[model samples]
Target: MNDRDRAPIDDTRFGAITVRQDGQDRIEVHGEAVPRVTLERDPAAEADPQIAIGTRDRSHLTMRVDGAEVDLLPAKGRLARHSYRVDVEYDGASYRLVPDSVPSSRLTRDGTHLGDFSSDGDETVIAEWREDRELRPADAAIGYALASAFGTGAQPMWMMIADGVSSALP
Candidate 1:
């Protein structure tokens, strides 16, 4: 665990959030068991010229956090029914979700990819800087995808709920 992981616990305003990989995508948060998930079959299993080469279909990805499950795919519409991959839109920024590999997932925010996560069988490790932010349902959904693809713990994105402060990127 690092300082970023402890901020929420040390500061009650951030609440006590603990995300650690237990098995597969399953995680433990504050002693609560978070469920693991696999990629759902894409409705449009057809080849997508947009997806990176070597990438496979993973339509539905779910992540459980704090007793709540968040689905990364669209909740409604044709894309929800057809596309296995989904992009997240929030605060004017778009987060593109992609399955780089079976044990890796990538989240690209506004063209500048934040980072990627990989599963080590026993734990999840982020390849770049990981920050805590106040996340919405869509944001949380993406977080879960990262956890599932990387087989890591979930990050706390509801900072505002604990302390009315803005930790999101500008």
Candidate 2:
């Protein structure tokens, strides 16, 4: 679906950002510094995380949007926190995606509730807003960044950390 038909973003979450984009490489936020967007990945990611034993390492997709960066980390295990989590910090706002088996995943900005993205059918994912909020064009920019970064299904470096943490447990 288009942005117009999508759920609205709550004012308390990102009402301050009055900018938007056309799914392009740039996003301008009102009263916030614009970030330089880039798509990059570490070539020396041989020591990245892995679920299956293999000498070859997996490279994750990284997107640098303005001041914040978004990394899509592959799932280390079946029950990994998120198959791929986006660690992002845009302008002065921070965004996170917490994936769950039910109701899909939750998106938060600066510790505030933004909305929940769930599969609507076989081809679409819908975002359910917490409050009666209006989604800004800037919000779509963030989503585009995430989609670009995670579209390749690369494994993020954080997955190794999570795996290490899990291994340390008795």
Candidate 3:
């Protein structure tokens, strides 16, 4: 099904072409069926929570979208909130989702530009991406994989300390 046939974003738990919060710790990407993909915190992850993307057999820090296993790697930075600075590739295109200060994030592909993700000071995540129908699903997966940086109770002790230290220097 195409975008036209898909359910409205607010009507679906997730969107056929977008991602949405299922609860505090779980998110779902709706499409094809009720939830084509789901992302949640990996209980076994060390330090900061590693995201598990996909349905029942989800993998940590990886999102299976558009037939590609996009690994959300921690883009090298001085912070331990590993998910906040994420790098991934999908449909053979490289993308990075980095923080643009608090309550906002930037998503760039091949270092060109796409859009940004910002919080409404609540549990909701809002994204403004270029009007490209083809990339919407990929963008949703990539952005939601790290969107928790703006979610409540997501910052672990290590992340707080790392961010604090990094902010103090330079």
- Error (Å) of candidate 1 at residue 51 is 20
For residues 1-170, could you state the per-residue lDDT of candidate 3 as single tens digits? 34354443442223434445543345555444332444454545442323222222224434555445555565434444334566676667887777665556777878766777765422355666665534545555556545643331235447678888999999
Strongest candidate by TM-score? 3
Tell me the tens digit of each residue's lDDT in model 2 across 23-109: 322222232322335444444444222311111112434455554555434343334446555556656666766564444656667
Q: How does each model score on TM-score?
A: 0.33, 0.42, 0.53
User: How far is 1's C-alpha from truth in model 3 (Å)?
Assistant: 25
Which wins on lDDT, candidate 1 or candidate 3?
Answer: 3
The number of the candidate with the highest lDDT is 3
Candidate 1: RMSD to truth: 15.6
Off by over 4 Å in 2: 1-59, 66-84, 119-123, 133-136, 144-170
Ranking by TM-score: 3, 2, 1
N/CA/C clash count, model 2: 6
Candidate 1 local distance difference test against the native = 0.38
How do the residues 38-137 of candidate 1 rate in per-residue lDDT, one tens digit apiece? 2332333453332211123334233333344443443221112123334554446676655454445565667655555444422233333235533333
Task: Please give the lDDT score for candidate 3.
Answer: 0.51
Error of 2 at 155 (Å): 19
